[model samples]
Target: MKKKTRTRLLVITACLLLFGLFLRGNPDEIIPFGLVIGGAALIIYGVKNRRQGGQPTVLPIMTKEKEAHYLESGMTEKEIEFFRETMNQTKKQILQLQENINQNAKLKAIDLRHDTLRASKALFKELVKDPQKLHFANHFLYTHLPNMVDLTDKFIEINGHEIKTKETYEKIEESSQIIDQMAALIAKDYQQFVADDLEDLDVELSIAKQSLKRDNSL
Candidate 1:
C-alpha cells in the first residue's frame, strides 16, 4: 500500500477502535447507534479508498524559477510543467517581437506594439493553466506570433536605411499598422483561451468538494 493510503487506514482504524472502546466502557448507558454506524461506515470507506487507490485533490503549480510565487496555487506537477513550457515559448516570441518593435523608427508604432506585446504576455499567463484549451490558441501561437515578428523585423531593416521617399515611409507605417492590428487581435483571443478552462475548473472543484462532503458524512 502507498504510504498515504497506509496512513489513512491507520487513522480510520484508530478512530473506529476508540469508538468501540467508548461503547464498551459505557455498555449499559444507551449509547447512540448512529455513532457506531458512522464509525463503521468510515472504516469501510477508508478500505474502499485504499482498494481504489484514491489520491488527494490538493495540487500545487509552481516553477522552480518563480521563487515561491504562487505558493498557494493548486496544480499538479504535470500542470506546472505544461504551464512553464508554454510560458517559456511565449516569452521567447514576445522578446523577439519586442526587439523588432524597439528598433522601429516610428515612436507611436513602437509604443503601440510594446503595449500590445505586454498585454499578450499577461494573457499568456492567464491562459496557461488550461493546457486543453491551448489548442484553441494555435493560430496565435503558430501564425500570428511568428508573422508579427517577421514583419516587424523586415520593416526595421528596411526603415533603418533611408527616408528619401514618402512611399517608403508609407510602407513602414503600413507594416507597423499590420503588426499592431495582429497583436490586438491576438490579445482578443485570450478571453476565448481561458473561458473553457475556467468553466471546467469550476465543475471539477464542485465535484471534488461534493465528494469530500459525502466521504466525510460516511
Candidate 2:
C-alpha cells in the first residue's frame, strides 16, 4: 500500500478506536462494542490487504514539489488533479491509436494519416508541458481526438476483412477521406491553441527588425 493509503487507514482506525473507548466508558452504551469490533476488523483488513500487495484505492498522490509547481502555474489542486487524469487518459488513447495505425499496412501507406497522428501527438506533448492551457483544448480532448481514434479503429477493422466487396472498398475509401479531414481539423485545433504564442513571436520579430533598421540608419 502507498504511504498515503496507510496514513489514511491509520487515522481512520485511530478515530474509531477513540470513539469506541469513549463509548466504552459509558457502561450502558452497547454501541462501544460494535465500534471497537469494527475498528479492529478495519485494521486487520488493511494489514492483510497490504500483505497481499493490493493496489491503493486512491488517485495518484501529488508530491509537495509537484503541487507547488502547478500552483505557480495558477492551477488549483482540483484542476491539477483533473488535468493529470485527463492527460493520462488522452495519452493512452493516442498510443493505442498509434499502435493500430502502425499495425495496419494500409494505414501505414497513407501519408496523410501519419502526418495527422504526428500533429496530434505533438499537440498532446505541448498540453503535457502546460496543463493550464487545457481549457483551450476542450474540443480536441473531448471530441476530435476521441472521434478520430474511434473512426480509425473502425476503418482498420473494415480494412482487415480477408474478403472485400466493391461496397466494402468504397466504404474504406470514404473512411480514409473522413479520417484525413479529421486530421486536418486536429492540425487546425493545434494551431488555434498556440495562435497567441505564434502571434506574440511574430510581433517580437517585427519589433527586432525595425530596431535593427533604425540603428543601421544612424
Candidate 3:
C-alpha cells in the first residue's frame, strides 16, 4: 500500500474509534463494541503492512504515444528512458528548492535576487521540448542544480537554530552569498544553453532583412 493509502486508513480508524466512544452509553452496546473492534483491527493491519514494507516505489513509464513522439524526434528507447529519469530527478530537486525557499525568508530573497526558481523551471521546460539536447545541460542537471538544493537545505538547517554565535552568523552570511552566486550561475546556464537557438533566430532575421532589401531595390 502507498503511504497515502495507509495514512487514510489510519485516519478512518481514528474516526471510528471516536464514534465508538461517543456511542458508549447507547442501549445497544454491540454497535459501539463492533466499531471499536473494527477500528483496532484496521490499526493493527496498517501497522503490520507498514512494518513489512508496504510497496515498492513505482517508476514512471513512457506510454506508446510519448515514445512515438520522442522517436520522431530521433531519440532511441534508451535515450528516452534516460531523459525521463533525468527530468524526474531534476524536477524533484527544483521542487525541494522551491519548498525550501518558501520556508526561509533568506532563501526567498535569494530566489528573488535573480528569479532562480523560475529560471530553473524554465530550463526544465526547454529540455522537455528537446530532450536530445540534454547533453548540453549535464552540469546544470548533475552538479549546479544539485548543489543549489544541498546549499539551501544546509542554510535552512542552520537558520533554524534558536541560538546563534558570531561564527554561526558568519557561516549563515557565507552560505547566503554562495547561494546567491549559484542562482546567478543557474541563470547563466539557461542563457548558455539557449545561445545556439538565439543565434539561429538572428540568422533567420538577417536572411529575412536581406530578402526585403532586395525586394525594395527591385
Against the true structure, whose TM-score is highest?
3
Question: Model 1: residues >4 Å from true position, as ranges?
Answer: 1-87, 105-114, 195-218
TM-score per prediction, in order, is 0.46, 0.68, 0.70
lDDT of 1 at 45: 70
Give the least accurate 10-residue stretch of model 1, judged by summed lDDT: 63-72
Tens digit per residue, CA lDDT, model 1, 53-88: 775433245456452433336555566566567667
TM-score of 1: 0.46
Model 2: per-residue Cα lDDT over 1-218, one tens digit each? 77668667876776676677676686455466656666776787689777778854355667888778788899986898788888877888889778877877666665354476777788898887787889899988999889888988999899989999999999999998887777778888888888998999999999999999999999
Off by over 4 Å in 3: 1-57, 216-218
Ranking by lDDT: 3, 2, 1
True-structure RMSD for candidate 3: 12.2
The local distance difference test score of each candidate is 0.67, 0.80, 0.87
Residue 23 deviation, candidate 1, in Å? 99
Error of 1 at 103 (Å): 3.2
Residue 86 error, candidate 2, Å: 0.6
